[model samples]
Target: MRPVFRLLSDELIERIISQARDILCDLGMEIHNDGVLSMLSDHGASVDSEKMHVYFTADIIDKALETAPDSVKLFDVMGRQTHDLTDHNVYFTPGSAAINILDPLSGEIRKPLTADYVEYAKLVSRLDNIASQSTAFIPSDVHEKISDSYRLFLSLLYCEKPVVTGAFTIDAFNVMKDLQLAVRGSADALKEKPLTIFSCCPTAPLKWSDVTSQNLVDCAKHFIPVEYISMPLSGFMAPVTLVGSLVQHTAETLSGVVLSQLTQPGTPIIYGGSPAAFDIRFETTPMGAVETQMMDCAYNEIGKYLNLPTQAYIALSDAKKLDAQAGLETSMGATLAALAGINNISGPGMLDFESCQSLEKLVVDNEICGMTLRLARGIEPKEDFPAIPIFEELLREKHLLIANHTRKHLRDEHYFPGRVIDRANSSRWEEEGSLTIGDRAKSEIARLQGEYEPSGLSGDILAEMTRLMRAEAARFGMARLPHEDL
Candidate 1:
């Protein structure tokens, strides 16, 4: 119900402001992108091209927060239900940008296909634990025709849940628009409530890319929520000190929020980051490393101080295989984020420094998400004391709480595990075929797939979507589209 950890107190927030001012004045972010620099100059923020630094003060950040909505309604594409981001419970979403899916049995990495992505999406949508879904897995290779927008399209087609997505290129915006049309069946549907788009802008200490900046502006105009993901690699792109990283992340995220607000006042935004560190010896960005977890915890504090909806990259690992280290890191990072009460936690099923995804892991992570959600609900105190006289009488004879009244309460209080999780003893498990967790998970996936009924799309609406997608493809000068079946 309440956040278990606070990263920034009143004194700490002031300290972050002081440090941000120092970074801008002394060591500034490198703005290699010219367009970003020009925008900064156009705004009141100071930009020195020579120094390649953009200095944004706390006042600018305040104005940005003021323009941002405290909460946003994330719409379900299937017109099922909307999730209120203002709720106290932390929501879990699937991972993002995974190029490979690690084979748990073989330990070999394989490129994921569109079918694989669709299956995964359906699986996630069916799970009660996942509050939202992301086109988390991208096909490693697709026909050139649909290569550009394949992931977004697949996500729109397969998922019925609220989607957490980002724009990879300028054209991706159009892809999103087409998908919106498909979901709503008409342009007027968008006017009521458009799909929430979370566009990531590079860190404050780093210039926003041209494509990313343009996408942010477009999303604001469409009234889509833009989630500014400030990924500052401390000890590499940023200072190694925690305070230093926090300051840089704050300034960068605030700047993004400001730009979105300036483009469209009252636009919703999430203060988010994927800040991590480069493993010096390994020469890699460790997604589930302890340092990454620490950064996530600290930055979450910073976001709370600003009083904005927060999103963080957690529930990932650096391990190439689903080994002990992978399990440990992913569990630790995910549990910490959940306990801290982050609004949105990403990076489930992610591995190999966030470059790979595993379907098996995704299912396993959903169980973790389910456990965390239960934990976040905290322990409920009994209102009526549960028939004190009867309970005391039962306790007097025996310590067993399995009496009729107690049994009823126990059933109500317990959180049941799904098919994949084994609570049975060895004897019972052996009788049931002695399946390992992975085997059981695969079976569960198959069962769900068999039972899943595709969301109803009228023939007319389907035709319209096909027409628009083809028209867009033609506009892009492509004769064929990738994943045409979608």
Candidate 2:
């Protein structure tokens, strides 16, 4: 773990604490749904439906935080890798829930398709820094051929990295099971180390959709780690005040933890959210705004106050095009999230309010993630700090001592540049056609794909996946598999 900067000053933290205490004591949260209202009422919270306020004592909030796990392990499908979540580093991914694909060549947004999903997965798999592969986007056209779960199936087959997935429907739950079976090779393997699956439940005063709630319960019953996503929009879904928003988020996430723990005690659950404010003038959720940044920072504080592992939404932008604004927003958001010690930071390759995905942006965001991780690690002191003697010896010695011990140490300490990021002069750049960042990123992606080899699955397992996929295709009444051979 690295030392994190306290985003909130001591006075600010105290103020937040005082505000939270006030909210719990006075203005309380609203619980519109009966189940949630009953749960709160059973606890120490006082529910007033007419006033739309639910008050809780400090003890209840403390209990919820105490219940959450400090760490979680996300398993790789091949059973080859498990990302230990205890390390407080920022992890990046391409994008999530992108309905449109930005054409790398033309820069035009188009409805996503199955081919796009496969290609996106392959692109994500080739990147070294992307720690986990997410179903990058929801293909708009796959609805007719296969259910929404087709993305999960494609991600499992095409992605070799650890996966982050969820079930959108009951059929999708079955698809998740089949996908898990395909990855683990048997039901017994699943029982041994079930793959990590994160499911989101909408925050109150709205009710959790039946489909998403059932999926979370099912994932818990199966012992899969579930990340309860609480996306509360301040001034809209939640109260306008910051502390009010935090309480609402905390309450909703605690509700999710309670359900998961009740279904199966000690099931791993993370306190996660993508909360932000609804811009009053535009009536749009601004992901890159300072308000969004503050919201994430404050929510993170609430998560930490509970002493649980935390996750936050950052590294995303609302920029309509990739330019300086995009760079600034993405860089700042990602930097803050990393410094805040968020376990898993999403929204790397995302843009245009997260409605579009871009390959170029993914590579850029990945480099930023690398830089953020390096920043978090800070600098370690060299065991022997006395380099003055070596410098003195070199200064006395005449010409440059290139092979000196000090020189050797200097070379060992530096991070070398790669093909994508250039450290060249203007003349050298002109000779190379003054390539744009996107052009360089495309070359890098091509280079990686050319050199990359898929992690081999057993021939028997491969054949089984193929057979199951074909059967699934047949059941869906599709004439052919999405890919002739996955």
- Regions more than 4 Å wrong, model 1: 1-3, 21-43, 47-59, 103-107, 143-148, 185-194, 384-387, 393-412, 474-486
**Candidate 1 accuracy as TM-score:** 0.89
Lowest lDDT 10-residue stretch of candidate 1:
140-149
lDDT of 2 by residue, 1-486 (tens): 466755555566556556655655566655445555565577767878675456766666556556656777666667764566654645665557777777777788887777777777777877766788776677765444454567777777667776666766655676567667777867767756656556566655534565666676677667777777777788987898766676667666765665566555666777777778879899988889877877786777666665666776678888866677778998898888888877777788888887888777777777787777777777666535686766676677754456466476664445443666677898999899899887887777677657656656666666666676666667767656656643
Tens digits of lDDT, candidate 1, 165-205: 77677776876776676778666566456565565767445
After TM-score superposition, what is the CA distance of residue 217 in candidate 2 from its true location, in Å? 0.6
Cα misplacement distance, residue 115 of candidate 2 (Å): 1.8
Which clashing pairs does model 2 show?
none
In angstroms, give how far residue 451 of model 1 lies from its true place: 2.0
Show the colliding residue pairs in model 1. none
